[model samples]
Target: MTTVALLDYGSGNLRSAERAIAATGAETIVTADPGTVLAADGLVVPGVGAFAACMEGLRAVNGPRLIGSRLAGGRPVLGICVGMQVLFDRGVEFAEGIHAPEAADEAGEAAPQAVGAPGCGEWPGTVERLDAAVLPHMGWNTVEVALGSRLFAGLDPNERYYFVHSYAARRWELTDTGRIAAPLVHWAEHDGCRFVAAVENGPLWATQFHPEKSGAAGAALLRNWVATLD
Candidate 1:
């Protein structure tokens, strides 16, 4: 049987994610062991809460090295929620709100207000607060699936997935260098501002939404990804 390793770096709903993945018929193990993480047929990196904090936890367990090692060898990896945010270059979490700026310093210069946390840098782009009237873009939402997206394959265009997030990658910055294929980027909107909802780039796949809590649509998406595992 195929085995999937869920990286336990003191973040995410491990049991829920494990159960969701296991439902796809793959043997899922929640482990922080380096050996198990690298040797597994597929790896899931799930995260919640603040971006910088998640990075700190991931670093404690040498997650960056393990994930890099697996991807370097063309092994598959999946990320969810803040897990997906950490995959980007940076995550800018504001202290007050998106529109609120900090008071100027004594020198009459604007003080740095936002907490700009660095991410894993697997992809180019910054995960920042969504420009919307509402606080968090909670509840169900639909995504515009990318062409040739193995991740969103067989999913209906109108299929809605559960999303509970405030910050997200507002744009896809990575361009085709011709040397390698461009990544398949999926977009979703919240109050007119669109953001990256999912990404499928070679061996690495991720989603900003929680698949484990997304009902039937989420389950089907998990199944599609699990089907690609060896």
Candidate 2:
């Protein structure tokens, strides 16, 4: 059986994410312990609230190394919402609650604030702030997955799912399927902006939308995530 590690970083939407993963019948371990994470077959990092605060939690629990190890080991990892963005190099722009123009005033140019923490990343992907669409990108929107990914398993062509995010990924390429230890589907575009809806770099599958809140199509997506372990 697939051992799915449902990470609980104190303030998180633990129960719902757990239910989504559990529906796949994988063993779900929701805890603050890093050791439990290291031992798991698959890892799910689910988060809500501010980005900086979550990073603090990930650091306090020694999640940096724990998660990095899993990613390096090619263990399946799933990141949702803020969890998805966390995998990037850094999100100083959003974390500071400032826009690019404002950030430019702070620095010479629009640059991400580098965190001194060990586990925190520099936010490898890009961040797209769309003006035409509403902020948070709330409600249902169609997700045009890159192509051929476990995250989009059993999904019909041109499927739609719910979303809620003000910022979207500015850049992220689809992982080379062959070398993907935690493969990802990257930077799906909607309303002229590309966003990282789901990413699989090998064993990891991360999405910005809440699969648990996505209903039937989401349930099928979760099942697909489970199938990858087989």
Candidate 3:
């Protein structure tokens, strides 16, 4: 059996995530120990909170420095939601209202001019304001899956998954050449501007949607994730 370590960072939707993975018949362990993480067959860094809190929690639980080494060992590592955002060097969040949109616009413009932009941090890309039909993008929405990722296994392109978040990842357009993979984007309209809804890179997959809220299709997706364990 592939051992899965659900890194407990004090707060998150752990019970639901645990139940989803368990449906796949894999063993799950909630842990705050670094040794437990390093010994696992695969690691899942799950989170639901501010970016700074998530980062601090990871450090607190696993000494802050173990993440890179544990993840880089080639063992499968999955970061769900905020956990996924942390996989990048940094992320854009709404902790500060001042960061709502104008900040994103300024960051967008400064990317080319500055080697490193302020609000966007060191993400190797820039952030943009999402123009979705509704803001905070709650309820159910379907993702246009990127075929071959295995993350979307057993799900259709039009299938709607549950979401309850205001911020989404939109850091690709401003990226320098070779900095971004063939990015995957989902959409909605807010402020008459369209923006990225999700992103995936090699060995890393994340989404703002909570599978636990998505019903059977979501459960199957979690199972598919478990099945991929070597």
Worst 10 residues of 3 by lDDT: 113-122
Would you give me the overall lDDT of model 2?
0.71
- What are the lDDT figures for the candidates, one per model? 0.89, 0.71, 0.60
Separately for all candidates shown, the number of backbone clashes (residues 3 or more apart, or on different chains) is 0, 30, 7
Best by TM-score: 1
TM agreement with the true structure for every prediction: 0.92, 0.81, 0.75
lDDT per residue for candidate 3 within 29-99, as digits (tens), equals: 98877788778776777777566677777766652455566645655666666665565555455544323
Off by over 4 Å in 3: 94-123, 126-133, 173-200
Pitting candidate 1 against candidate 2, the one with the higher TM-score is 1
TM-score, structure 2 vs. true: 0.81
lDDT of 2 by residue, 188-221 (tens): 5566676677766666667888888899989898
Q: Which stretches of model 2 miss by more than 4 angstroms?
A: 94-119, 126-128, 131-133, 173-184
What lDDT does model 1 reach? 0.89
